[model samples]
Target chain A: MGGKVAVIDYGMGNLHSVASALEHVGAGEVLVTHDAAVIAEADRVVFPGVGAIRDCMAEIRRLRCDELLRSALVEQHKPVLAICVGMQALLQRSDENEGVDCLSLIDGEVRYFGNPLTDSEGTRLKVPHMGWNEVQQMKAHPLWAGIADRTRFYFVHSYYVAATDREMVAASVDYGVSADAALARDNLFAVQFHPEKSATAGLTLLKNFVNWNGQC
Target chain B: MALAKRIIPCLDVENGRVVKGVNFVDIRDAGDPVEIAQRYNDQGADEVTFLDITASHEGRDTTVHTVERIAEQVFIPLTVGGGIRSVDDIRTMLNAGADKVSINTAAIHNPELVRDAAQRFGSQCIVVAIDAKRVGDVDGQPRYEIFTHGGRKPTGIDAVAWARKMADLGAGEILLTSMDRDGTKNGFELGVTRAITDAVEIPVIASGGVGNLDHLVDGVLEGGADAVLAASIFHFGEYTVPEAKAYMAARGIEVRL
Candidate 1:
């Protein structure tokens, strides 16, 4: 329940709130930093982002944090969390901005949750998918520890993750179709939902992330 | 699964402190903003809105600091409104840890502000708050106009049309407050609320005129708002957030329980 948690800030996220959430969850020495060296040394790295994908990928490449993240994941094997646009950035490409390249850290593509979105039961759903939805756990992972299955989590996004490898998808929630909600591979865990802004279940998930061992 | 309905608690603060005296309840001196926010969060409030009712220029800074304090304590979605005029104001509040910023009069003056904020910070963070009052009847039918300056200056703009325009301009949500029902504690103006809700596809938070628990239920059931925001009833502790959720849940409303 305690470890140095560094939130990767690229000038376009709710960094302060994410850092505060970690602090509130009893994490030790939570730091919101863009310094590659600081993020490289932290016990856990949370790459938090909001806004558009074009600007997000632009900033990630501009600051060379992309390279830092590459090494952090492949070389150091640190437990890393990507949220919202941060999660989108980890994919190969996104349909946003008419098609933008991404970090390709995971086996997925960032796609727009089509206009006139509707759920499985033929019920109409809204774009942006703002608010809380129940996430069905697809795999038993440590990050979900202390959290009940199908607990609701707050989300605010217009794009969703479409992963090619089904084994890597840790959870998928239905909204028109079964949308991949969480992707887990090795030390990397990326979620389309904002854990910091989500209520009790969110807090518990972050607490679990802080205490995770980065094992499968 | 359908998205759960939200319960939002609105706090009107003046000069950095929460303006007390709701009715028949003790809060121990207006209760600290941070403490009150935490209590609401624990009570299962989906979101908490802070309205800076300070007229003085200096009170703006006080509200900003209060948002900073409350943000550190409360983890749920925190929306800060009142006196938000420009993109800089929105950025300042966001940096201070507000998840979203609600704009009123300024948006009316410069309608482009909503589009600008939506483009810059995404539509999910921009909440266009419309204060509406029913104008003179036209042929046995009621017409609502947008009001500003504490609901004093009438813009003569149709509320339902403005709500549609706000959504067209890329606003994520609409916070509709009825001037007639505000502070009345009678009930929400479902006629206007449903009109706006039906006109726009975006999320709408029906605010004002929440007296009893049924009023909250009516806001969602009758008005069809995505969220319900109440002030006095919650501020005075007439009913807790969970109690309201339970009430709504029993009525078959999908709320996060």
Candidate 2:
């Protein structure tokens, strides 16, 4: 799949790993840019970010990436993938920084994993939930093509997404709580985990994204 | 299933070459850091960490170059530690494609560096590496003190309390190493390991003295660590990463395999 791929960068986090991962998988002409014209010309767009939601939204709005992404996902019907904080930014709001408004592209809100997060056995679970965890496919989608069910993916975040529209959730994972792992609606596919840093399983997911054509 | 505990194989690099110095003495060359990282990645290692022990300024560039090659090929979480003194150092490593930068002596020198780096790069990329050793007993409890300069200098800081402070200051994870047990192959200092893991809400990577695969499991089961790190055990070809994971999985511990 040697098509132009645009990786949206708004200075919120590192783009090296994502770009390199895409290139490593032979995804053609991976461009890490904030330029709207380049993104508009690309066959696909990857919305990737890390850090706090408040700062992410600040940059997104400042650079008018919100409008760019809005056009890509809402109007153009292009295949768009959002990752980590990039996924959280698509929600209506988040509990971080005492609450911050998001893109509302998907009907959802981000909730913290709790200060003293505990399992059913009353054992305290770590925050940042940083490690590999299984992603159970909730609904069938194109991206899950070659990937097996319950494949482990790398995750690192303090908050998790809860979509108001349950049908949008494509996969779920159990931390201290059952959290939405991947959400899908039409042409947009977003994941709460970093597929780039997730190794083979992650590379397979990104490869599926490269080959997907905005179809269910 | 819940989050699987990670088994990280750490590489001690000097001048872009992997080296293992027992207790900071009698160093032996292992291989290329990039090659070693890829081998571990193939064997299903959860993540790879590079501890740059290069003391010379000229040799430091090689470490960055080594990280660049590994990040380009190995698509896993890569952490670079050792001699990371400032925010610029953190940025340099991250730009070179490291997922996290672990700061050890620097965090003790300027405690604010931890907070500053976390705020600048986000907590997910900031790791505070604590090299501590048992100092004595305090009220019938084993007391540990933070050590810097390759476990030669004492900071007079409480190990458990310092882990809490680093977490509150915005460290994403803590790489806790026991200097006493580092090269002895006796296993981790479980007492202090459990103490720090329970003290903080963030994830902790237990390091030092992983003589065998059982020590890896013990680090998680007994020490309550979110992850366990070892260098020589995997580096010396004594055991492969898949074998370690299988051992842990057979013992009823959740692993990726």
Candidate 3:
């Protein structure tokens, strides 16, 4: 069989939508599996999550998806894509559900976008940060291939990634705060937005990710 | 830059077909739901809302086949409503590829449905649609009451107050439709729309009574809506989505066009 694409499912996130998206992007034999061996055997792995971080981490630990993801990125050096809560889980900790510890794969923290979210002009912006917004590439990366700079992608989240290292922030978007929209370090790439629902730009990114070889 | 005020084209679907009429009378087929959704996506629609008008009466779930078809071709955010009553229903739609689901009658009947759905799914995927009309009273406050069953029955709840309650109940957004102005083409009921928008912190989608491009401008500028939703104008070929966006952008309102 050709190299398969595995989408790690810990029973959270819209696994169906992500699988459908991966299939649409011509990922070729996309498998949504909780089995570790199957995931490890795949050439590329995708870890996607949604909903609260507490429950997300609970299920991740339950199914040992955390270890699966770690090995995929650290040991195998395979191209691993983390999306939304999946991206947040890669960080050290998150201030959601009061506070929750994360995988600490990346040296960053996930924090709430505090109520009364407003731009510099003091005008209110909605939480959940719904709808499409621009993401400007911080540095060139393989995943950003074929995608233009500052292209709009669909975002639906309240918590955002705050990395201490500017070098890790591969792309940034202004959502009241200049947040890191996408992060890249070594073989790992994660984005706060839902590329699956991003329409043309989103689908194109997924296609690029499927074709991407773990490179800087 | 600030987030652009969205312009959405809603499709009223029945028996898996897009239908149009004035106040739900003498319904006429507009086009296929999947085809219409793709056309809007190509025409630069900010988002699309599909209201399955027959699901409730038939005592069935959402039109998943149609939603799946639309989701395949149209890539933007899709929100499906009508007969979305429970968490399972929400999951079914999301599984079929809808980004969000709007609950109206069910949410009003079972307010916990909103909280539960928001908790199970993320609040971002839960939208509480409140179809309302101004209840002119003799002795009490002149408040807008919530209407369900295609605006056929009016609940005694106040529209603005219920909006605040739904936002508090974990609804990520509010889809506000004015029953009085729905098919009259007079424009959105600005007073009630602004009232609900100001009352809630979440984004509010102002729906119903969009007859022209100028009405869309008014929905955002005067009504204080985060988005403007219309069907007849866009369906009847009165104005293309991009053309409407251009009209709004020329008037100094931000749009994705």
Q: Write the per-residue lDDT of candidate 1 for residues A72-111, one digit (tens) a residue.
A: 7889998988888888899999998899999988877988
Clashing pairs in 3: none
Q: Which RMSD values do the candidates have, in order?
A: 2.5, 1.1, 1.9
TM-score of the B chain in each candidate versus the native B chain: 0.94, 0.98, 0.96
Give lDDT tens digits, candidate 3, residues A163-207: 978899999889899888999988889999888877788888889
- TM-score (chain B) for model 1? 0.94
Q: Candidate 2 lDDT, tens digit per residue, A46-120? A: 999888788889999999999999987887888999999999999999998899999999887999999888888
List candidate 3 stretches off by more than 4 Å: A1-3, B59-62, B137-142
On the 0 to 100 scale, the lDDT of residue B41 in model 3 is 88
Off by over 4 Å in 2: B55-59
Contacts from the true interface found in each model, as a fraction, amount to: 0.51, 0.81, 0.38
TM-score of chain A of 2: 0.98
Candidate 3 all-Cα RMSD: 1.9
Ten contiguous residues minimizing lDDT sum, candidate 3 chain B: B53-62
Q: How good is the docking of model 1, by CAPRI class?
A: medium
lDDT of each: 0.85, 0.91, 0.88
User: Using DockQ as the measure, what is the rank order of every candidate, best first?
Assistant: 2, 1, 3
Best by TM-score: 2
- The residue-by-residue lDDT of candidate 2 on B127-152, one tens digit each, is 99999999999899999999987788
For candidate 3, give the docking quality class from DockQ.
medium
Model 1 lDDT vs. the true structure?
Answer: 0.85
